[model samples]
Target: MKLLVVGATGTLGRQIVRRALDEGHEVQCLVRSFQRGAFLREWGAQLLRGNLCAPQTLPPALEGVEAVIDAATARPTDAIDQVDWDGKVNLIKAAKAAGVNRYVFISILGAEKYPDVPLMNIKHCTEKFLAESGLDYTILKPCGFLQGLIGQYAIPILEKQGIWVMNGAAPIAYMNTQDIARFAIAALDNPDTVKRSFPLAGSRAWDSNEIIRLCERLTGQDARVSRMPLGLLRTVKKILTYFQWGWNVADRLAFTEVVVGSEAIIAPMDEVYETFHIDSGEITTVEEYLGEYFSRIMKKLRELDYDREKASKKKLPF
Candidate 1:
């Protein structure tokens, strides 16, 4: 299969590209800048220079590609309409024009139910557009990405003090990007996944306290946690947005209110496992993931400390 992956530099996109290549597919990645895709080129993926917001840059990227996996998003609230909504619609049109067979889209888990939220509304609208675009489509509504949360929230806090939880007791399932990529690869070729919109989640759900305990067990260090009321968190996010901060305040608040405020974001895994013939045990556990991650961090810190000590010794006078 000849595959075109949009947003190939992103966390999930890189995983999907690597997985697709490992599966022996000819992969092409659409990137805004050639320099950004240097790693992709080294990994044997053909690179197409294009911007999703520019329709003229899309046709060449789509030509001769059998399928497309869209994982693109515009950061902050300002660019959602142009990049997330319009850009995707343009890509769908280009894919249709190029006679592309399958279009796979990555969307949020609860986007359909909360269309009023700005980011969710845009994604929901794009999902509708893809469904009606006269093309075979697979829309994957995945829960919170486990690696993403760890990188953004867990690692930084664990390195300093403790993890912060907006609602400590809320049930949330964190799915690994690797598993999502596997399912996406299956969707690209499997007829059973065609025209199907399904919720993807990890095998288990954990609250914030459980996550902290897992972190403690993995790092063998005291993992402190700070909890905040959900309503208070929302208020702070709103104020941050009002101040025009660079962070994606609107999207963050929506995620907090919708995903974090709700019970576990999950679906029956047996059917998907059976259909794709994937093993449930293959799904990564939070402990295994955090253990390896913090180990690397600790190793790097040790190296830095050793370098500093060597430098001090060099500066010492006998």
Candidate 2:
């Protein structure tokens, strides 16, 4: 399979590229900057410079492409309306024109229910656009990414910085990007997955307090926790909505509804596991993921300290 992977520099996109290449498929990555995508080229993926915002830049990348895995999304500083809405609309049209067989779109867990939130509404609109575009497509709605938790929780705790959370943050079944990548590639080849939506999730759901305690246990460090009332986020969203410069921040803050919404943005993936022919046990749990991260980080810190001690001892008069 000759595949075009969007957002190849992202956590999930990079994993999908690696898996596709490892599985003996030719991979082409659509990247904005060659400098940013240099590592993907080193991994044996062909790079085509393209931007979703520019519809003309997309078709050339899709030439000779058998499948498309779109994991692209707007960055924090980016204009969400342009990238998520206009850009996605362009990509779907271009893919349909190119006669691409398999199209896999990575979407969030509860996009359809949140019309008030700009990002969610854009995603849901894009999902509808693709579904009605007369192209073979599969939409995977994945829960929170576990790899994201490292910076948001692990590093903050290790560095003794504030780990911020909503007062009553909901428990999320955060799936590993590597595992999500596996399922994405599986969907790309499976005919049954065409025009269907599947929930990609981890084995267990974990809350903020549980994760903080887990981090403390693994790193042997006390976490400086800061709690924000969800009500304040709603108020901030309302104020930021009036300002154009603050649109991105306001769009992000709109995601707070997930924490307070009735559905917890998680799903029982027993049917999904069976459909993809993946076993439930193969999914990485929160504990195993955190445990490995801390162990590796601790080892690196120890090696750095040992090197410094050895250098100091050499300079001393015994």
Candidate 3:
């Protein structure tokens, strides 16, 4: 099938494009510029110049597109209403008019529950729009991304920076981006996935302190930890909201509310695995994922040290 992928340059979007192409499907990406998408073109996926903010740019891109995989999102710096919500609304309309067969959407876990969080609210609203758009759609709500956690916690720990662990941060089942892509592409074919939504998560849910301890053990170093009270976070978020330009910052701060809730952000995936015909054992765990990352980073650091030692020795008299 000829497929159209929105947000093709994103972490999860690129994976979907790569996997979709490997599966022998014709892939097209909707990007704002061809230059930013040069690598995507090199990957053999056709690039269509378009932006979700511009509704006029969408219909043309959806032409002859059999399936549409929308992994696009607004950044913290971007307005969620314009990009995430309105942009997706336009894309949904365009896909409907283009007579697209199937649509796959990526959403966060419990999007509707976190109405105060700007990003999550927009995502939930988009999901509702997509569901009611009279199109065949599959929504995949992911708990969290392991790749994000690495940057948020692991790298900071290595640099001896303050690890921001909240008073009562929730445990999250963080899955690898590659695995989510697998589920998204798999949904493109399975009839069972149509008009259905599934939660994609890792084998286990891990909290902040647990992850911090894991990183310390892996790198053999103590983390510079910053434990913020949940009350302080709320106060900061409230203060930021008072300013016109600080709304975006405040919105992001509200995201912590989702994690600090009564229960962890997780779901039962036994049925999901069976429906998608995926083996539970194949899922990547935090230990394996983090272990590989630390190993690679440690090797690079060791190589850098060796080069420095070699240069220093050359300057010595002996």
- TM-score computed on alpha carbons, candidate 1: 0.88
The sequence of per-residue lDDT tens digits that candidate 1 reaches over residues 1-318 is: 999999889889999999999999999999988898999999999999998889999999988999999988885544667898889989999999999999999998878778667788888899899989999999988877888757545675567665667764466678889999999998987888888887888878877777777776666677566777878877777777766553466665765677666566777778888777789899887777777787897798789999998998795475
The best-first sequence of candidates by TM-score reads 2, 3, 1
Lowest lDDT 10-residue stretch of candidate 1:
243-252
Q: Cα lDDT of all candidates, in order?
A: 0.83, 0.90, 0.90
- Which ten-residue region of model 3 has the weakest summed lDDT? 253-262
lDDT of 3: 0.90
Best by TM-score: 2
Candidate 2 stretches greater than 4 Å from native: 259-263, 315-318
